[model samples]
Target chain A: MGKNVLLVDDSKTMRIIIGRSLRQAGIDFDNIFEAADGIEALEVLEKETVDIVLSDINMPNMDGISFLREKSTRDAIKDIPVLMISTETGDDIIGEAKSLGAVGAIKKPFTPDKVNEVLGPLL
Target chain B: MEIQDKMIDATKEIFSTMIMMEINLEEITDVHGPLTDTITAMIGLAGKRKGVLAVHFPYPVALAITSSFLMMDVEEMNDDVHDAMGEIANMLGGNIKTILSENGRDIDLSMPSTIAGSEYSFQSDKDVEKVIISFSTEKGSFMVEMDLEK
Candidate 1:
């Protein structure tokens, strides 16, 4: 069985698109999780063991940043590497995510190659 | 804040970050207003200020941007073109909503809608200022043209 991964974003369309990308990048697993936003993602986290987190920056009710902060304090969740995918690209936001505890950053409108590049080493 | 400034800032932010392209804003003399966009993605914003903000792209430019953005080749504009344009607008609008919310003018954003057709011209109403900010991406040229009023 491949490693379990959790994908988080607000848009259903995006979630589906990214989910397909993940499959194409050889993330063949039945345990792949999806969440509408960070809050819901946390709920999923509390129950299951996720190998890595792929999240979008812009989401409602506790954004990805807040989720990263919360994940850092939890002993069970802290070890999982997080990859931030977003449209809001700036040095500040990327730095903040890294400082707050994301393993890598990928900008939006991504290709399969980029997705594989980000996930290849960690997963 | 003027809608024009809002447009310049947001468009620059999105295009530069996502496409790795810089946009130059030069006002066109033949302002097509709302209809000037050969390909337009618009959404209804309701709140203290209610209006539609459309991101318009020319046919070839639209195809190029959409192809690069989605990592696919688009020979011509079709349903996929409309969906792609709507998504691009959604991104720009989503960022705009955040900016507007911070300024204490909150609004709900409707899903993006697109219009692509031949032989169409859009001119803003007389009271409203129809501003066109011209930009060239690595792919081609496009504009963020709008008609709005408080």
Candidate 2:
């Protein structure tokens, strides 16, 4: 069975690109959910059975770091792995995301091979 | 690698890897002129280094790139074009940010903003170090400018 995945990003274009790349990477998902920001992402988590979250770091309502922090505190979603997919390139930010319970991080303009390599073990 | 080289590499990689478009370096110019009938996307950088990065695209180029990125035929400047431009700027700025970080400069990237118009010019602070690199592909041509307020 495939895992259920949630994708969070403010840009609709980016979401579509990421979805295409995910399929190209051969990461099959039972169900794929989309959210525009952290707040919306939390709402989706409330109703869906998601196994993994792929999120962008910068968003309007709530950013990825804040979402990860919130996710870490909730028992229902705490165990689900969060992987940041963003254009942020600071070690400080990446470290902070990890501390907040993010399993991994992928920079923008990412290739399908790189996505698969980073997410294969976690999913 | 030099800053200009880094920027060029980022642009090439993003276009080819993310958008599946092949791009070639056309030239690097120091000329500053008003961009008419063009779209420009900008991203701010802060922390150890502070500045802005802007990518300028002629209308045809912007439409072509946006269409390829969205997997649709974009006829005019619309929401998809704006979003794609912002994302492209973000990706380019993000890669450049990583190179700076590796060199021991801690930097933070801001969300991108885009502007489109028939006539307009950008004026930066006098203290900034500005570098502009131009590129072309079968689809069209564009320029990427890095303005660092040192």
Candidate 3:
């Protein structure tokens, strides 16, 4: 069966760009789910069969760090790996994200090759 | 490299990689007069440093950029244009945050916003150190300005 991916970002433009980048990288998924923020991402995770999540760190309702922390506590959805694709890629922030259960990160202004390099291994 | 140079590189990278447009640095100036028929996307920086980062794009350039960014033809100034420009500013702001703050936790970035009009002035109320870099693309030119509190 093909894998599914969830994209969580506040900017609609960014979501579209990420989806495009995924296709450009030749990463195809059966389902490509989207959420505006961490809250919506959590809701999608609960309802959908998402294999992995691509999330942004800064958002309006609920940010990625809080989302990872909250998701970790839930038994049903905690294990799904989340790879942060954001502009906030400082060691301190990325380290904290790792502590919160994020599998990896791809900085903003990234290319399809960069996305593939970082995200392909996880899949 | 200096902050201005870093900003130039960051802006170029964003345009090249994400927007699929190659832009070259045209000029580095201290002041630019009032804008006309343009849109500006800005983001604030707080905490360890306090200031703003803004990108100014004329309607034509903005339309071209939004079109290239989404791989769709954008002919007018719409929400998609605003959002795309805001995301560009947001990405530039994040790069600047990394340049200013080592850990990235020291500086907090505000939500990105947009301002569009026929004419307006963009200036800081408080004393600031400003750097404005102009860039040119096939469609037209745009400016990236950074103002940090002294």
Candidate 4:
């Protein structure tokens, strides 16, 4: 069965592009939820069952790192894997995401192949 | 790699992968005159390097990119076009920031802003190092300018 996925990003265009790339990567999802930021993503989680999350690091009103930290403390959603997608190449940022229970990270301007490579085993 | 090369590569990659537009570097030149009938997006960077990165698109080029990005025909440069342009700048600036930070420069990017008009002009501060590069696609041409105070 396809997994349920949640996409969090402030940019509408980026959400669409990431959705397209996910499909192109052959990672089918039973349900794909979209949120403008981490705050909205938590709202989505309140009502939906998400098996994985793909989020961008920078956003207004709750960024991805904060979301990961929040998700890490929640028993209901803590097990669901989170993958960060951002243009941030800082080692410290990536390390922080990893410590917060992010399964992996994907840099921006990612191709379908790169997406598949990072998410294939996890999904 | 040099900063200019990194910016060029980031622009090419983002346009090609995200927007599905094949863009080639045309030339790297000095800052130009006022851009009429254009849309511009700017994002600021702070920390180890303080600067602003701006992307300027002619109306036709902006329309084409907006259409491709939203998967609809954008005849007029409206809010959607403005948002699309801003997102493009954010991605471009974000990628450039990552490249710089990886090479030993720490930088933080600010939220992007977009403006669409025909009569405005863009000028950088005198102390900043300005690098302007022009890129061409089949649809039209645009420029990416980076002004950094390192």
- Maximum-lDDT candidate: 3
User: Candidate 1 lDDT, tens digit per residue, B26-99?
Assistant: 66433653444388888766685556667778888888876765667888877767877776777776565655
Off by over 4 Å in 4: B102-105
The digit string of per-residue lDDT tens for model 3 on B59-86 reads 9999999999999999989999999999
lDDT of 3 by residue, A12-110 (tens): 999999999999999999999999999999999999999999999989889999999999999999999999999999999999999999999999989
- Which is the better candidate, 1 or 4, if ranked by lDDT? 4
CA lDDT, every prediction?
0.72, 0.88, 0.95, 0.87
Q: What digit string (tens of lDDT, one per residue) describes model 2 on residues B100-143?
A: 77642468778899999999997685688889999987867799
Span of 10 residues, lowest total lDDT, candidate 2 chain B: B99-108
Clash-forming residue pairs, model 1: B35-B122
lDDT of 1 by residue, A1-123 (tens): 667888898765566567777877776756879997888998889898788889987677878889999988888878788899875455566678899889888776676678899888886
A31 Cα displacement, candidate 1 (Å): 7.9
Give the winner by DockQ.
3
Q: What is the C-alpha lDDT profile of model 2 across A85-117, one tens digit per residue?
A: 998847788888999989999988899999999
Which residue pairs of candidate 2 clash? none
Highest TM-score model number: 3
Against the hidden true structure, what lDDT does model 2 obtain? 0.88
Better model by lDDT, 1 or 3?
3
Please state the CAPRI-style docking class of candidate 2: medium
